[model samples]
Target: MRLAAALISCVLCVTGTVGGAWLSRPASVDYGSLLSKASDIYAVTDERGDATRLYVVNNASNAAISRIPGAAAELPWKVNVTYSLDGPNVEANEISGASGLVGIYIDVKPQSSAANHTIPVVTFTVPTQVTGDISADNTASVATQGSDIVVAAAGNVSSGLKFSCYMDAKK
Candidate 1:
């Protein structure tokens, strides 16, 4: 009789725990386009002090369905943007050289999220432009807490003129 009672208790405990987790998530997450929010949004600026925001634009709701299997350590997000500058007064060479005025880059890892929210797991200057010499394709990564996995990414661009920055994460 005691064995049966304990088995029943274990099943109920598991069900309750799973149910509670499902309920804790924001309701909008159920029907909205946002798949998930791995960490709070962050703002990154350039040498000229123009600021652009960063966040995971799209994330997997579950590990089995993740588009970024390599980023399994933390939810993966897309940093998509385009920046441009053209003016009659400005020199063509100057515009072409500094075309990618704003950069947004991130390697979604667990530590960069809720666990060590006080500090950035990694930090470095944003690449000023996409040039053969500068190598805007530079990358970085962080280790996952539970696995041997690492998350990595290269810089992404956003437009500018005299260095202005903006982010569109409402979607």
Candidate 2:
């Protein structure tokens, strides 16, 4: 009788201990910030028929760098911009030179607010000219030397726009 009682007690103790351990396991956790980089900056314009305001922010800092007026005219259905290092060295007037190139592409939905009623593809080089109207995909390339920059905008009516620019490196 004593052995059977002891056996029952042992089983109960083991079951209780196992149950307690199983119930006390740690829960899963997710700990990390979504944005964490300087190159992660992006901007988007507000809706049309309203104020022409631009919203710019950096993901790393999660802060608004600037909110300038006239930055963008209308809300683009879709906007995509990319930059790349074109060449380590370039030829300038038969002379070897080095410069950095930055490209910007914008696609704006057709809207009626301004007089021209034409979507303008502006470049850093000739900020004055309208360049021309672009299709859904507009690409503009610019090369920078110090503060000066030269830009080219290619109009894409049937297809897409393709442009290029040149810059001179500081001596």
Candidate 3:
């Protein structure tokens, strides 16, 4: 009887220690940031100019969070998005061609009952132009299916510009 009681107590101690360690792990998101609230959609724009507009959609809820007006002052080039097992992060390339690249970071707000803060699920860069011409118009779109991120943008000197991208999950 005495041996059995001692073994039981030892097992309980080990189980409690393991459970506490798992619960004490750090969260992936920063609770104090703007992304602490829920966000259904988002957009990206250039603060310098209004030349390009990048639109993002959270298809599950169908919300739009970010936007860029036109090609007058803003010129967006490339937008890259990545979603991993850890979380999601979006990067916007604000510069075009060989000039350089500017990165924009996005954070999603957490759910009301979530244990941690909001997480970042996308990352990309915006494209830039060489001539800095404000005459052309451009539009871009981004979407995610599972772990992949897609972006598409199109533009024309005569009519205008339009681009769209969509990424599907891997098998």
Top TM-score model: 2
RMSD of 3: 25.0
lDDT score, candidate 1, position 123: 23
Query: Which rank order by TM-score, best down to worst?
Result: 2, 1, 3
Ranking by lDDT: 2, 1, 3
- Please report the candidate that would top lDDT against the real structure: 2
- Positional deviation of residue 152's Cα in model 1 after best superposition, in angstroms: 18
Identify the runs in model 1 with alpha carbons over 4 angstroms from their true place.
1-68, 75-80, 87-171
lDDT of 2 by residue, 1-171 (tens): 111111100121111221121114458754223333234535453566454643333444555456566756443222344333354332333222323342233333323333122233434432212222212222443333244333434332223334433332222
lDDT, model 1: 0.28
TM-score of each: 0.16, 0.24, 0.15
Worst 10 residues of 3 by lDDT: 1-10
**Model 1 Cα shift for residue 72 (angstroms):** 3.4
lDDT of 1 at 72: 66
